[model samples]
Target: MVREKFTHIYARAADRKGGEAELESLLATPLSAQELKGISDDRWLSAFTQKVFQSGMSWKVVRNKWPNFEEVFFGFDIEKMLLMPTEMWERKATDPAIIRHLGKVMTIPENARMIHDAALDHCSFSAMVADWPAEDITGLWRYLKAHGKRLGGNTGPYTLRIMGKDTFILSHDVEAYLRNIGVIDGGRDTRKSLQATQQAFSEWQQESGRPLCQISQIIAFSQGDNRL
Candidate 1:
């Protein structure tokens, strides 16, 4: 099984790095259910927007200006964002507080509407995210891509990880590892590749009793980078 290959990689990484404890240090602890529930929907929106803007830019830049982004976006209030005038958004294209890219600037309202619609249907965006089964977390990624604007590719999964969801990030390193082990055949983001990755994670979870986040980090760590 793929889990055995991954375990061997982990063992090799542990040996090179001194011990299993060092490998553990490279992993981030996923948020508990209570912790996840405590996070507000607005915060989820902020996280989503952050990931969207960080897509092709330096995350450090986005992170550094996040406080100003919070102020300019009206604290990411869903309703307010949904109703914000076009002129304000246009004006923000020149704002120093946030990334001034017009295209990225435009996604704010569209994504806000996406979050608003999800909240309308599921009570709250946070609730919708909190309710999805972690075992099929890739399905959540699919849902976000289909329903939310600018949430395609790894953005949705990364956003989920940022929100403390027990999800995996199929980063290039992880994908390469999967391909090397034959869990997947190519790097294409097609449904087949996604399903293969999802099934592999499912098996690993059942075999290891670990969340997708930790499994993903382990796979990355197994590659000897240990920086996930």
Candidate 2:
């Protein structure tokens, strides 16, 4: 369960699937702090809302209607969304362009306010996310779950990944790998399991000098699945 073991597993998988270069191509490079900081708050809000609504629904449906969502939500303008009246969102529940789920529709403004508040406190929502230590990304996940509406479990982590942050996702294959590595006993999403996963990644980062995203992808790929 050391760094070398993980590397060996990745090497074998890469060899089996057309070699190291191909495996590298499958991994996403994380954005730099400066690049992340430059992203607008509206875009951040949009990404958060997309991930929120995509939860427990077909991603294809969300993807197909994203343009409509953007249109109706005013491009997810944080200030404008913050000012949206309750009745306005209620009316949107029956709109055909976007998903008509009332609870998900309602979360848009609430999450927009959360983004706005983060911007108010830190000058920009991107800055707050960029400032979080990548080595302790689980802490950032915890922060989002506590402060942002409907950003619990994988939602926060998935949002951060889509935003190009240097974080690990506990996907099915990744969880299986973690358990196989003795990082967790039951694959439960508990604080202890998260801490163990974090510590293991920190160790692997030190040993391999790779970003968490790539490391996570390698672990997932090592499980014989192409899904990232």
Provide the RMSD of all predictions against the true structure, rounded to 1 decimal: 2.0, 1.9
**In model 2, where do residues sit more than 4 Å from their true spots?**
1-4
TM-score to native of every candidate shown: 0.92, 0.94
lDDT of 2 by residue, 1-228 (tens): 453556686786687668888887788999999999999999988898889889999999899999999998899888888788899889988898888999988888888888888888999999999999977899998888888889988898989999988999998888887777688886456889888889988988887789998888788787655733
- Model 1: per-residue lDDT, tens digit, 9-60? 6686677667898878777778877677778778878988899899999999
Candidate lDDT scores, in order, read 0.82, 0.85
